[model samples]
Target: MEHNLSKHISGKFNQDLENVRNHVLAMGGLVEQQLNSALDAVSANDSEQARQVEKDDYKVNAMEVSIDEECTRIIAKRQPAASDLRLVVAIAKTIADLERIGDEARRIAQVALDSFSKEQQDLLVMIDNMGRQVSKMLHDVLDAFARMDVEAAFKVHKEDAKVDREYEALIRQIMTYMMEDPRSIPKIMALVWSVRSLERIGDRCQNIAEYVIYFVKGKDIRHISQEDIEKDILKL
Candidate 1:
């Protein structure tokens, strides 16, 4: 009789874990959609689309709270140990990152609402490219998390460096333009802010990939150097 009860409890715990995992994935899907909408709005300079993206942020925020609550409940009730506990913790962290990415998307949407001069249109093109790159990174990292693929996560981490270089190049170009014509400063500044937000989104995606590594290997590689991270991942 005791053995049967233990088995039943174990099954219930597994179900709860699966439920939370699904919730996180759902939240990730919503976040990805929000990002793409915001980027598209900016590229097309569509205020209505940008407004919709801004309004939808509330849904993402709500999902973050819901997922966190569910994770907390599972931890409190199940008292999961070892790998199970790691999974819960990683899910919670990933949700937090996703919520921040949502915030960044909203900021990008706000940029779309701003008035841009014809001269600034070319700059928006560069920002659009950055947005698309980060959006792809986010999509890839989420897939890695879903599959628990450490190798894929590592590849995503490397992609972040490319995004960083692109961001830097964009900033340099904008600065050059500002120096050439101070009158374009305001528009250029807005583009700079938008690019920065996209860069942050990339950072968040990288962080999520790191969490995937932690989930699979049970290692905390948050602050380690890239050299060390590469070595550690290779060892796996």
Candidate 2:
């Protein structure tokens, strides 16, 4: 009877761990869907689709809260240490970034459907490309977490620099146009907001990549050197 009870408790604990993992993956799926919806809304200039993103923001917020609460409960009850602890802590931290990324994507969708004229629409091409790249980076980082693939995470981290450069050049080009013609103020401001939203997405990608190190090797990889990130990636 004692052996049977111990086996039952162990099985239940493993089941709870699996539940926690699924909750995180479900949250990831929701965010990925949000990004895709925002992209479609932007590309089509659909105000209804933009409204959908705005509506969906609440879901992401709620999921973040749920995951956070669940993690807290698991840590207190299970007393996980080492790698298990790292995974829980990393999820708790990364959920915030994921929520913020969802917000940024929704903001872009809103701004894309804003009252910009035809000419302003043409200039949104670069902004669109940046959005695609950032979304893919987010997806890739999540994949790394799923598989514990450190190399994939680092690749996402390095790719963010290109996004940053693109954003800088984009800002410069817009300012030049605005300077060349003062009458383009409102359109330029709208474009600026759009570009800023895309840039923010890239920033979140960088944060998520840093969390990957903690998820695997139990290290606070933030503010650490590139060489260290590379070394961790080499392990997977």
Candidate 3:
């Protein structure tokens, strides 16, 4: 009878953990959609689409709150140890990153409402490319989390450098345009803000990748050198 009760408890705990994992994935999906929509708004310079993206941010915020409460409840009820504890901790941290990413997306949408001339449209192409790259990184990191694949997470981490380079290149191009034509300053400044938000979204995606590694290896690799991270990944 005691063994049967122990099995029942363990099964219940597993179910609860799975439930939380599913919720986190669902939240991630919503965040990804919000990001893509915001990027679309920027590409089209559509105020209505931007406003809709801003409104969608509330749903992301609500999911963050709900997921956090569920994690706290699981901790209090199950008193999980070891891997189970790590799972909950990683989920909580990832949710926080996702919420911040959503905020960045909303900022990008706000920038989209600004008017730009036809000459400035060429500049937007670069921003659109950057957004697409970061969107792919976000999608890949979420997949890594779902599969618990540390290798995939590491790939996403490495991809962040590319996003950073793209941002730098865009900045240089914008500065050149600003120097050549002072009249475009206002619109160029708005594009700068939008790209900055896109750059931040890339950073947030990297954070999610780090959480994926933590969930798989039970190791915290934040603030460490790439060399050290590579070494750790090799061990697994």
Compare the candidates by TM-score and give the number of the best one: 1
Candidate 1 per-residue lDDT over residues 1-236, each given as its tens digit? 00111222356588888788889999999999999999999988899999999999999999999999999999889898877787888899999999999999999988889878787788889889889999999999998888777888888988999999999999999999899999888767878888999999999999998888887777888888778977865463
Q: For each candidate, what TM-score against the reference?
A: 0.93, 0.88, 0.92
Q: What is the lDDT of residue 89 in candidate 1?
A: 88
Query: Clashing residue pairs, candidate 2?
Result: none
lDDT of 1 at 214: 82
Model 1 steric clash total: 0
Candidate 2 lDDT over 97-141, as tens digits, reads 889888887877786467666766666766777778878888888
* lDDT of each residue in 116-228, candidate 3, tens digit only: 87888888878889999999999999988887778888889989999999999999999999999998887688888889988998998899888877766778888988788
Candidate number of the best lDDT? 1
Deviation (Å) of 202 in candidate 3: 1.0
Winner on lDDT between 2 and 3 is: 3
RMSD each, Å: 4.9, 5.6, 4.8
- Clash count for each candidate, listed in order shown: 0, 0, 0
Clashing residue pairs in candidate 3, if any? none
Residue 72 CA error for candidate 3 (Å)?
Answer: 0.7
- State in Å the error of residue 113, model 1: 0.9
